[model samples]
Target: MSPRWKWKGAEAKALAEPISKTVSILQSSLTRTEASGLLSNHNVLLSVEAEQAELLDRSCFGRPVVACAEKEDKRWIQLTFEEAFFLFYNLNCIKISLHGRRLENEVELWRFVRSIKPNFATSYKAYSHLRLKNWIVRPGLQYGVDFVVYRHHPSLVHSEFAVLVKSVDGNDRLRVWSDSHCSVRLTGSVAKTLLVLYINGEEVNREDMNLPLCLEDYTVEEVTVRRWSPELNREHDLSL
Candidate 1:
């Protein structure tokens, strides 16, 4: 299937919610309460449709579900807050509802996501870029990075890259030596490349934040870190 699809009015209503998003169980029949019960553990989305369930099957966005209703037909997939925000603002695939009402534009969506996570704009920029590249991007908290990128779906293979997103803003401090050292060890242990992605752009002007934020306007420099073991470097050293 193509990675993108349009949502019908009814479909939007069934999946999007106001305070937070809620997805109804559509693939199978289930009450709203049952769907809500399925999302209680994951603080991502408020609910999900049981039929198109993905989160339970795999850790799509890096957020894992701890406890969910057991019935197969009763299962649903809820996008975490970050996932919902990313879908609406970055991908332009889904619209979100607010308190029984649908949002009018991207600005409103940006406001909502920012209100929930103060650093969402920065995080979203990095997220949007990787996602647009079509990589399987998931949370990287476990790897001491911003995201774990899979060339193939997570279920099929281990992640190939662990990404750390950094901004151009001087206010953000440089990563300490210890942090970098630790990240290299952690990612290496898991057989993943550590990519430090430095994003260059102006600080977001929330009031003037435009819809369809042009990611091209910004730039990224990806630095890959690898531990230099003397044993592994012997061949190169001999050549030198």
Candidate 2:
């Protein structure tokens, strides 16, 4: 049997808007010089298709979907906005190879979002945090911290925390590596923030441990546990 694939709905939607806007901007901004640059970067010859020629002549915004065609010799080719961005970013040109021939823009933001895995991870983390009632969690660019969790009620007087997620393949081996990396990243002034190590289910330990709490690993899971501070660390009493 094949492993189950998880679906994230909210993230799939957030990615669409930005991709649509980028397509519109690129279409309007493509000048003779820019076009030449794009062609040179991708190492492709460029000619606009008749259908899209008038669309290019006029300015359009937030269309979400558009198609462009390329001309080479006697042939005319069509492309999507997703293909256009890929060409622009990777080859520095607008021409793309789709459905056998060179094609031009039909950039759907969702398509671009689906192609890149990291963006999905960030989105998943954001959604997960939001669902946990952490309203202030947003995407962070620097210091390798994926999500910042803020205190929901300011009156409760708890420190804000940062969550670092590591998707590891194995239990024992990945735990050591995950710990070292998390420690280094969460050290110094930010050390006060709780360091939670979320792992996939595979390994089990006999005893309940304390401090810089190492929670049990689970597969396809979400659990929020408070970090063990030196002052708050206590032994698990079996005397019930």
Candidate 3:
């Protein structure tokens, strides 16, 4: 079983245990019960007090703005919405609160997060998919993609793939030829593969949002694209 907490801060430990009544009651269409059980035997929600949130100003949750020792931290939570959900939904480490009131269960939390991010389900499906496969995922804003994945920790190895989310409803985005070429070219320049995740291409959103978290309702397919080079395509000294 996965460890309950990555860092056992006093407050985080206090926050991590205790299965909410709502969690066990939820009837999500769990497509991978075995995988889910491997991480958390019970379901999880999310939360962090402002004081505890301040602690996240470091490397794990967020980055140091100036990299100097004496600067006031003028940054937001470093973890993206997706990352937060991963900590809650996958790791079951924290319960999320808005306006200081905790969102008691996954159903309530999912609705809240979905309201803020229209593409929550699709984005999260890809994020959790990579995570379940044991890849380290981080936001790819710098690379102009949805995510960047590492085989190991960022300090141990550089990111190996840049991910782009493509939803059937198109709430996130799909690249055209020029955009696609640019994405491929950019990732290639940095020695990374460009992977596009097509979410729910043939399947439509389940009408009842509650039925979706199981991953059975969402379908994600990955496609990797690279720009072919004639000069590099030849073997040895053979001409193309």
The TM-score leader among the candidates is 1
lDDT of 3 at 39: 14
| Deviation in Å, model 2, residue 72 alpha carbon | 45
Top of the candidates by lDDT: 3
**How does candidate 3 fare on TM-score?**
0.64
Query: lDDT tens string, model 2, 104-132?
Result: 43232223333543233223433333423
Task: Please write out the lDDT profile of model 3 over residues 1-240, one tens digit for every residue.
Answer: 112222336334333422222122221212112112111112222223333334432113434233423324222243566666665667665556655566666777677667777777888899888876756677899999989986544544567889998876674444468787788889889888999888774455455654345455677788988887888766766653
Candidate 2 weakest ten by summed lDDT:
207-216
Off by over 4 Å in 1: 1-49, 54-75, 170-174, 203-206, 209-216, 237-240
lDDT of 1: 0.57
TM-score of model number 1: 0.66
What does the lDDT come to for candidate 2? 0.36
Candidate 1, RMSD to the unseen true structure: 10.5
**Residue lDDT tens for model 1, 84-166:** 66555553445456655667776766666556666566677777777666566788887777788865445445678888878
Pairs that collide, model 3 = 29-214, 45-95, 46-94, 46-95, 46-96, 47-95, 47-96
